[model samples]
Target: MNAPTASHHLLPQVQARDVPKALLDALQARFGAQFSAAMAVREQHGRDESAFDIPPPAAVVFAQNTQDVSDAVKLAAQYLVPVIPFGVGSSLEGHLLAVQGGISLDVSRMDAVLSINAEDLTVTVQPGVTRKALNEAVKSSGLFFPIDPGADATIGGMSATRASGTNAVRYGTMRENVLALEVVTASGEVIRTGTRAKKSSAGYDLTRLLVGSEGTLGVMTEITVKLYPLPEAVMAATCSFPTLADAVNTTIQIIQMGVPIARCELLDENTIRMVNAHSKLSLPESSMLLFEFHGSPDGVKEQVAVVQEIAGEHGAAAFAWAETPEERTRLWTARHNAYFAGVQSRPGCKAITTDACVPISHLADALLDSVTEAQEAGLPYFMVGHVGDGNFHMGYLIDPTKPEERELAETLNHQLVERALKLGGTCTGEHGVGLHKQGFLVEETGNGAVEMMRTIKRALDPHNILNPGKIFSL
Candidate 1:
């Protein structure tokens, strides 16, 4: 959640050259109207959902195909200008920002569902295909893509950030769902890694390397990701707890017992109140757990019974079940809108989100202490998370004009990351180390491992033109 400070000057600018007029003219001629140098368009492409100050790109390229992406990158390579891949600009971190001032490669126009192998339970999509679109496209096949990051983000952006969401507890994150990727390297060379096969012992696993690279190593043009068969019977439930510890403990027990919960989300009383006002729903304004169970009817009932017993032990209230699809949608939709609800609760305020993931065994300690710390600091914050996977976010809403408020939020984030690291977790569970977590990345991985990453970056992008000043510095 911290903004960029002065210490992030480790990497040298690529040749220290401006995006030349010649390069912009060449791109405009090659792509015609798809290329734009208008300040408004450039400004729109530069900023994302992050709270960072806007750093606009020199130009914008609306790439419609892999060839278009290659051409843009090829041209940028020639001019030694950085190429930042843009996908919906829904990212919470500064992944899409043109920090070094170059080209914003907009891939949203390349939206397409290339292939769907229902029998194989795999689908190939262009970079611009959003998660909801993919799920809707495959609905007839009785299968769905499960990695819903709640923002309706593009598949390419999801794959780039290694996104996970409420369903990640059971279906897994992008790292597990993505099978292969067709990438455009820094030199504009198109390459394919991995295949549709379920398993591969082929080579160095470049698919993973590029998956969470955040477009630093290359640009992901196409993705083949695993899919899941829709559950025969689905049931959603909400239960309130006496405190955050009680709710987290209930989740810990459910996961530890090997229950296959499809989605398990944690929301605090503050978030619950905001959701009630924003979504027009009435629910208890207490620490609550929302859960969804998948499988046959009997399986779901058994899972619910077991979870009910677990919750009862923690002094949880009676379960509120949603048996119908419409009812389930209403329940989950409220959960997804937690961010907007929180933002609207406080006028003229922005949320500085924190993503801290720890092991299941450590969830209770990690969450309870964090909530206590935030309360002690007197910061207006709300809590939500995919707790079934030991990942959660704390949205610290602060006025942009208040420097002290931003500083407090950043301090709280720093403490939370330190706590997660000490508990054998990561600085970022799903969000990559985009400008926000570079310092934490070092604390978590140590300098030697970071240097190894730098080595890879240099070998792959010697010119430092592909999304420079992200993850780590050279």
Candidate 2:
């Protein structure tokens, strides 16, 4: 029999009573009536937005405060049970999978805007605060948190994933926005890393270390992120291209010319078709570039003029611009809905997305080649990109019931990763290597670098009780 088949041989059934009683007792004592056996709704918290099927946590704890998280982690540490931090569960990668079957610390109950310091241009928020909620809360203050990942994902999950979106080109990503964090270590000690200062040469950059750690190192309780002042003028526009190459090339030109564009996203014809069906927007079935500019009226006009000239040289068609706030919002809303639209295009199909980032100069070639390769493989795929940042996503819709189809999809994904690495790019740009890209990480970073990462994981999570089976396996 094949190894995969042999491994699937009905293993000895394990009962819930096999779990450590001491840990359960401790949790019962700590939470009192707040905890319940029904909290073991593993099916609800097991998976993320990814296509993987993994086991959920043994129990779920709705943490309402930092102390609640601290206590939960402490008990899990005492019994050496895995503790996975879960947010909105909107992660594209399998970041929230409870592979070790312990406790999932759900922090959505902790949602609160702790403080908004307009003078400092920063906001301190509990982990559960969503990006949309934060934006609405600060709208009256004329400030906004600019890192938007399309989903109303919790601040904790976004920080954990180090997510970036269309606005990253102008406002920067979580790496640039997250000024500080209050974290609970594996042993349950609470510690704060970084300050509210705009710039810091301070101690080791622990804030960044935790930002993209994907919840393996610790649980984030509070986050302090930089805020940007609302732009005086915002302009949204869309331009179509005769060919994919033309659209990608135009994006390269726009970035090379250093036009202060807030967001520059590309959607291939395949994606546009899906969007039209899903969003009911009758857009031209051509590769398109969605752009946004933020500045004074004169600055916006100059930026748009330069972009138009560059795009026109590359055979851009129907360059429509939206100047009003309502119009701009409508434009962005459509763009943000692209992922859902792509998924809805093929009913009963799950999306297996690949995120690769390359140097700006190689982006056009890399993306064009990827689309061609996917086509040659006879795969149904769509491409959408944050072109200005040289990051893109190739979402392949596959039927989970077909084993051969799944294998083919995996093969295509592997080829895409190989191509990315060959072009001096990373397998993942925003999404972390949560199980799906572990092999890719080894191939990209090499064994030596991976060992260093494992060393850090060991140092921080000595018990391996924090998000076990993530980033790297023991």
Candidate 3:
């Protein structure tokens, strides 16, 4: 039952390129107070939620507007210094790391919604606008944006990584919602891609190219995304199952049956216990599926009835309905906090998080076997999933002082990724191929495909001055 062992997915050895003093002088002179060479700022922007311990960027530039981003990138391009576009630093992958010496371009100050075109069901926003902020801004319009990656992530970062979350089962991911973008090229040229129109065949679809490029491509300055009408009625419920398989099977059945559930999430017993302790709530400490149904009142009722039948057939217990908005918020907030719960479950421990997504029919195959491997390994771990879409996250909590545990955890992750790939799935669903998953990306997509990716990177960022040493090595 033990996880099949594989070599650790080691991070690339990044050689720090020296940052010329002239570049620093130019940036400081140009940006004044907006540019920082402060060690604290550098350190803060150096790492993300990922475990890789790379040195921080040499400097940080807080961009307050699209002009600021363009100017800063232009300055960096002049010195041929690497520029890593940063959001709120919520990235789970080592996306923000200055693996090569560079400047961290902080765009959180650009948090402004430019315009809300309610009539057109579209909104134009600054790259620094967070998902929660955008939703709050548009809630009054009766049209809401549905792609949320659970961390209150910036629309810019989400677009860069093609992020999706719980509601992706129905609405879709950032790749679908992002309609257009204003991107600053490696040469410091500002270019627009796509338009407000929903569909277009006019050109190369450069918008899609940049959506999931993970900042290795260009710096996104402005974004326009589609909005959806708020559902007439929303129902949130939790169903505890006798076994993890029952919970997953129930989710698989729900999707296969075309239930159109807004969110169908799975949390194993271990994860539920951690979340309960962390969030101070009494959720049933068993394998559980949290469901949210959105539609007309009658339509929601129909969907709920159908899901309940599916759960019953899979041995799920009675549904615990969160009928009120407050109750539903509490439940989802707790679900969103699952990563923190897993980390805090053991004091001072860090979790090496990874996710694998497969075809709906192969979800059980990809998830169940991985769960068994994790159980047999005897590592302290927690599991959760956006099961309606066949994407599951497994976090292996490890002691930093124990290198052996870290190695074991990585091996487990490698095994899981391999399994998902064998099952016709991806190594990462939303987290993107940051420093950690570069090797898996090659394995999953092949050398030729990765070479094509490298070609694209070279063609766009000729100097490799933008988030270099990410996605793939030149």
Number of the top TM-score candidate: 3
**Better candidate by TM-score, 1 or 2:** 1
Runs with alpha carbons beyond 4 Å of true place in candidate 3: 1-8
lDDT of 2 by residue, 1-474 (tens): 111221111122332222487787778788876554464466788878888777667777889999999999988888888888989888887878776678888899889999999989999999999999999999899999999878899999999988998888888889989999999999999999998998889879999999999999999999999998999988889999999999999988889988989999999998899888887788799999999889898999999999999999999997888878888877788888888887887789888877899988999778988898788878688788999999998888888898777666677777777777888999898887886787778879999999999999999999888887777776
Q: Which ten residues in a row have the lowest lDDT in candidate 1?
A: 6-15
Predicted model with the maximum lDDT: 3
Model 2 spans > 4 angstroms off? 1-18, 32-36
User: By TM-score, how accurate is candidate 2?
Assistant: 0.95
Q: After superposition on all CA atoms, what RMSD does each candidate show versus the true structure?
A: 2.3, 3.5, 1.4
How would the candidate models be sorted by lDDT, starting from the highest? Answer: 3, 1, 2
lDDT to native, each model: 0.90, 0.85, 0.91
**Which is the better candidate, 1 or 2, if ranked by lDDT?**
1
Q: What does candidate 3's lDDT look like per residue over 1-474, in tens digits? A: 234333236766668888899989988998999999999989999989988788889999999987888888888888889999999999987889998889999999889999999999999999999999999999999989898678989999999999999999999998998999999999889999999998999979999999999999899999999999999999999999999988888888888888889999999999999999999999899999999999999999999999999899999888999989999999999999999999999999988999989999999999999889899999999998999899999999999999999988988898899989998999999999888788888779998999999999999999999999888888
